[model samples]
Target: MRLADKVILVTGSCTGIGKAIARRCVQEGARVVLHGLETEWGEAVREELGADKSVLVIADLQDEATPALLVRTALDTFGRLDAVVNNAAWVASSNIHTTTPAFFRQMLEVNTLSAFFLIQEALPHLKERRGAVLNIGSVNAWCGEPDLLAYSVSKGALMTLTRNLGDALFREEGVRVNQINPGWVLTEKEIQRKQEHGMPVNWYELLPPEYAPSRRILDPAEIAAAAIYWLADESGPVSGQVVELEQYPVIGRNPPKK
Candidate 1:
């Protein structure tokens, strides 16, 4: 049991990567606080994980109060907090012309600011246990596609946040922080997203070699598997690091030969 007796909070956990992480955490012997915006999805996950081991928080991350509420729920329910996996984000497509100031602000509020506040709220408890923070970032943080300008900027800032706090907290307060930047992953929403773009139901079955060298995108479970190491004590004395979970190099790699 890598995370035996620990309590973890995972945002956006009613689905996708966050849900997978929460499930894995429970399987590894930890109780978890699951946060998301959908009531039905949240309840479904809570039911799946069982009320004995998991509780769901259904709220919008754009709300400033949500962070503190999440922390309070974890402590009030589980008695202590041991880890936080910030996995929620408002992912939308927009470039300069379409990105209004209000739009950009909302992006930051949901994707960047919420993570920061959640971490801040969880800090004191993490210090007591010398616990960890695992931020789920995206490979798009390193200069995303043209359509993802605001989202890229938000995640880029989050990467810096992870590094800065990862160092400061670990050195000053003994709370380790790290990040995982995952590439394209196949999640329920992604399937719907691709369908909205006119891809067929079986589109994921045959991905191009360029985007998926293994002929497929990643699985949330794969990302969840890697998450346990950072959250678990096995990663000892390390912080301020970001790992890119992609099949091949995201930077400086030549395009696949046509």
Candidate 2:
């Protein structure tokens, strides 16, 4: 049990990669605070993880005050807070032409600002415990597809935030901060989202090999597995790292090979 007796707070944990991270943390003996907008799914996860081991919190991160409230809730439920996984995000596909001020603001508020405030609110406790903060970023931060304009911008901002805070906090407060930029993970929400976008029920099975280098898209559990090392003490004082979790090299690659 790498995280034995740790108290971890994971946002957007009702489903997808967030849910998998929470589940994995619990399995590693960490008590968890699961936060999400989906009340039913959040409650279900609380039940599944067991009341004694986990608690559910429903929040809309867009609210400026929600981050503090979430941190307080986690502290109240458990005696202390050891780690926070900022996994909640808003992903709206919009290019420059389609992006309105309101939409852009909303995307930044949820995907970037929320994580900033959450870390701010949790800083005191994390510093006390010398704990870690794991931010779930996306490979799109490098340079997203045209369809993911706003999302890519938000993630890129998050990447910078991770680096800035990881260095500043570790040097000053002794709290470690790191981020993982995961590529194309096949989660429940993703499956449904793709379906709604007109992809067939068996779309994943039909994906070209080029789309998935290993003949399959990544899994939430695999991301969760990587998350554990960062969140746990075994990572040993490392910080300010933005790991790109993907099948292909993300940097210095041209369009493609003929």
Candidate 3:
């Protein structure tokens, strides 16, 4: 119960990483607010977590008013806000020629703009509690994921936003901010997409094993663990970092150190 009594707001919590993070926060004793576009699944999560403690805020993050509403609901329900997990994201696998203007806008709205607005609205409350903000970034921000160009670009902006906010907030308000760049994770959406497209998950064998050091998709819970750390006081002095959660190290030298 590292996060005991803390109030956390997690976006896109109906499934995947967001859902995993919300569950973990609840298990660790935090009062959580779960947001998602899916009404049924969001309500189910709220019930699963016990509606008395965990409320569901159903709203499209692309809407400008949703962020403020989420914050207000948290304060009204929990009396205060302590942490935020900006985990909502959207990605479309399309090459340059296939990508559309609307596609880019959707990606930026969900992956970047929503984060910006959430942070802006949550800042006043966060500053009051000296709370933390955990931005969900992606390794794709650094790696070339040409198929997900718009998503990659937006995630890059999110990474920079994390740094900029961390620096500014630390200096001015003493609030902690950090980012987690997770590697590929096998979620229900990925599984369904794979089945629908008849893509082979084992195709990774075609590439050198060293290219994908872990050799397996990351678990959402693993990523959630990292978020939990950032939300806790134990993460002291670790602000402004972009921590990558992958099976293998991406920072070490290409060849042997010797």
Candidate 4:
């Protein structure tokens, strides 16, 4: 039980990578506060994790008041806050020409600014516990495809926030901050997205070597496994580091295109 007795607040916990992480946290003996927009999905996870081990908060991070509400939920439900996983994001396809100011602001509000404020509101509690913050970034942060300008930029900002706060928080408050940039993971939404793009049934099974080095995309559980180390006491003073969780090196690499 690496995270035994810890209370973690995981945003976007109703689905995708956040759901996997929340389940893993419970498995590792941590009590978690799960937040999401959908009440049914949040209820499902709350039921799965049981009332004793988890609490569900149905909220939209777009609200200016949401960051504080999440923090309050953690403190009220769990009695303490030990860690936070910022995993919620707004992933959409929009190129430079298509991205309007309002759309860009919406993306930033959901993907970047909310995370910053959540950490800010949680700072006092995190400082008390010498806690940790884990930001879930995307490999697209570096340079995205033409159709992902706004989403990529938002993630890029999140990456920067992780690093900036990782250093400042570790030194000043003894709270560690770090991030994981995951490659393509086969989440429920992703599969549905592929189908929307006209991919046939079971489209991911035969991925080309260039994208999936081993002919398979990443799994959400894999990302969750990596998250445990950072949130656990085992990582030990490591801060301001961003790890790429892709199958291959993200920088200066040429895939076989097989």
Deviation of model 4 at 216, angstroms: 0.9
lDDT of 4 by residue, 1-258 (tens): 999999999999999999999999999999999999989988999999999999998889988889889989888888999999999998888997999999999999999999999999999999999999999999999997799999999999999999999999999999999999999999988998889989987999979888887999999999999999999999999998899999888888875753
Whole-model lDDT values for every prediction? 0.95, 0.93, 0.87, 0.94
- Rank order (by lDDT, best first): 1, 4, 2, 3
Model 3 misplaced stretches (Cα beyond 4 Å): 200-215, 251-258
Clashing pairs in 1: none
Total clashing pairs for each candidate: 0, 0, 0, 0
* Ranking of predictions according to TM-score: 1, 4, 2, 3
Candidate 1 TM-score to native: 0.98
Which portions of model 1 miss their true places by more than 4 Å?
none
Each model's Cα RMSD: 0.9, 1.1, 2.9, 1.0
Instruction: Report the C-alpha lDDT of model 2 over 44-108, residue by residue, as the tens digit.
Output: 99999999999988889988788888888888989899999999998768997999999999999
Q: What would the per-residue lDDT of candidate 3 be over residues 1-258, giving only the tens digit for each residue?
A: 799999999998998999999999999999899998889999888888997669998899988899999999999998999998999888568768877999888888999999989988999899998999999988888754778788888899999999998999988887889999998787767666666677676543343455455556788998998788899999986778899887676655366333
Cα error of candidate 4 at position 250, Å: 1.1
Clashes of 4: 0
* lDDT score, candidate 1: 0.95
